[model samples]
Target: MNTAAQPPVGEKVRCLACGEVFDASISVCPVCGASGEWLALYVPETNAFRRESEEIFLIVGGGIAAVSAAEAIRERNRLCSIVLFSEEAVLPYNRPMLTKAMFDSLAEEALAIHPRSWYEEHGIYLMLSKRVVSLLPEERELVTDDGAHFHYDKCILATGASCFIPPIEGTGLAGVVAIRSVTDAAAAARRAEAGQNAVVIGGGVLGLEAAWALKKAGCHVTVLENSPRLMMRNLDAAASALLQAAVEESGVAVVYSAQTDKINGTETVESVTLRDGTVLPADLVVVSCGVRANTALAQSAGIETGRAVVVDEHMETNLRGVYACGDCAEFRGVNRAVWPVAAEMGACAGANAAGEAAVYAEHPVPFTF
Candidate 1:
């Protein structure tokens, strides 16, 4: 189960329009606007599987930490089975590239680090498009959407975070998208047409990235922020201004100190009205406001929660044999949800799950994306 690339009931399906391999069952594309139906089915030619001894059911919430943890476990326990369960379709892929490579016209290669055979040779099971619905920490088990439960010696909750969309009046409109994952990114591209007015809420990294991606996709992009400046949490005004100017130079609009209220339209987003009585027309609205960690499964299982899943220095939770990582876990009082740290934590969690004392020391990982 752990050493193969099949999810509980899923596999790779290549997209015909973008020519990228995406999870077939995942309804939407994160890179392209292609539907899952557009993902050409490649019927398995054979049932050949390369499995190993000792199954380690690793229920990963986010792909990066889950995959990194699997590699670390494989480094020590070569014969142990590794199951990498991710809600994200892409497995162990880099999140940073969603910004830099979004407009790269011919980039077929995904942000994934390892090839398919790498998992096969090493006996790693990749479960893409699999969302863990509940956790049984007492039983050391996790339940999937399809009602299948997996028992584990160690379980990693890398479930990550979901983008927070403000409770705006017109939020139910058709053209609004949350640019958090690949699915959102691709939908934004399709929802926006050439010369359409697109408004992005929040001036965070994902907002800026979505602006760039939408602009490349031929939409006129405008960013709305309630903060007095851009990237307020990460950069000072001067640095933010430099980035703002750069984005504006690329034909994107940046409006600061603007509080958003509702997206206005009949069936789709047409304009946005601010709390301060300002109105701006928009054909598409991308919400990159903030992120809330997905801890429902853990919370349901009675695991204590803080801002996120409360984990110790070793990525272990309050419960024994249960661990948390990625965007969901707050470890050693640090709540930074960057990609690199998630991978590091995952590796540590996996090692500990395999009966080793893996310490998850905090490292200052740079975050430009």
Candidate 2:
């Protein structure tokens, strides 16, 4: 007797926290770790317009923005060649999960934004561990660090951002780390040991998350904020107080108005000395400073850059046929550098590049912690 096959088990769901669309079977948003409450049933609008062409679409950086651009392009054009270049050795994954789920087993398969089979089925080429060193906009060509060259009809620069580590003495210590990538998170996790003293510099959301993760790993975690309060930019006074209480209740110590003079150690991180002369014993130090947009490649190509590469509403750069999005693109002098904004900008850029009309509108970012 023949048995009936099981129907598909998951539907498309949009994460409210980061605007990432994923299968609903997943309990938490793979991008931002938002629970089911932040997920909404989503039915993608089918674009009836399709242009079959041999044009090559090139995307730099393997972040959410690059993935979204590829998806948007595939949605509009089925025959175009799409190639994505990434300096990372692995496929695109949810970056926010790096800090939010620091201690978890982040196997590439579990963290990937889309499975490897997804790229193969969609005809998108994955050029991993390839860093684009030069952009020749006039010739519509790109040169990688390894001297490989590729030509494109249209290009999107989503080089994203790099973590800014402040100049502090002893930062080169072995136990001092920053949480920026899966590899960085793994290094931090390896250093987090029971009964160890972990000092986290910066009291932003990312810093707090790392502190909590270290605390969970049985490390004595202390968060040092240079500002007067925690998340001063994102939270009001009352909310900040409430959050501070909650964080302290979770067994993580919080310090305000902290200025680090230097990290102290002979070989590894031994302690952190504040400007006030108070020294906090630390076995490991995690720096959660902010990030700066990666705009050197665009700047070298004569692209206009203020805080980042300037872009119009369509996410197109001053150079025609070239576009930028994510942390690398600044529109109206604003770049929130958030996941949702990056995804929206990338979708807009991809649509316009595919000969479809799409505009990006700035919106207020929703904060969920």
Clashes of each: 15, 0
Model 1 ranges off by over 4 Å: 1-55, 105-109
Give one digit per residue, the lDDT tens place, for model 2 in 1-369.
758543257677888876778887676787777875888887888778677788999999999889889988998889999999999999998888888788887789878988999999999999999999999987899999999889999999999998889999999999999887889999999988899999999999889989988999899999999999889998899999999999989999988999999999999999999999999999999998998999999999999999989999999999999999998889999978888888888888999899887889888788754
TM-score of each: 0.80, 0.96
In terms of TM-score, the best-performing candidate is: 2
The window of 10 residues in a row where model 1 has the poorest summed lDDT is 44-53
Assess the local accuracy of residue 169 in candidate 1 as a C-alpha lDDT between 0 and 100: 91
Evaluate residue 197 in candidate 2 and report its C-alpha lDDT on the 0 to 100 scale: 99
- Best candidate, lDDT-wise? 2
Query: What is the lDDT, from 0 to 100, of the residue 107 in candidate 1?
Result: 29
Give one digit per residue, the lDDT tens place, for model 1 in 1-369. 566444445576655554444565555544444674576765643312333458665766656677767766776676776787777666566565555455542122455656677788878888877877888776778788889988887677888877887788988889888866666556666676788888988878778887887888798888997787788888888998898789879998888899887788999888999988989989888888788887887888888898899998778888887888878888766677776577667777876776676567775554535
Residue 190, candidate 1: Cα error in Å is 1.4
Assess the local accuracy of residue 236 in candidate 1 as a C-alpha lDDT between 0 and 100. 86
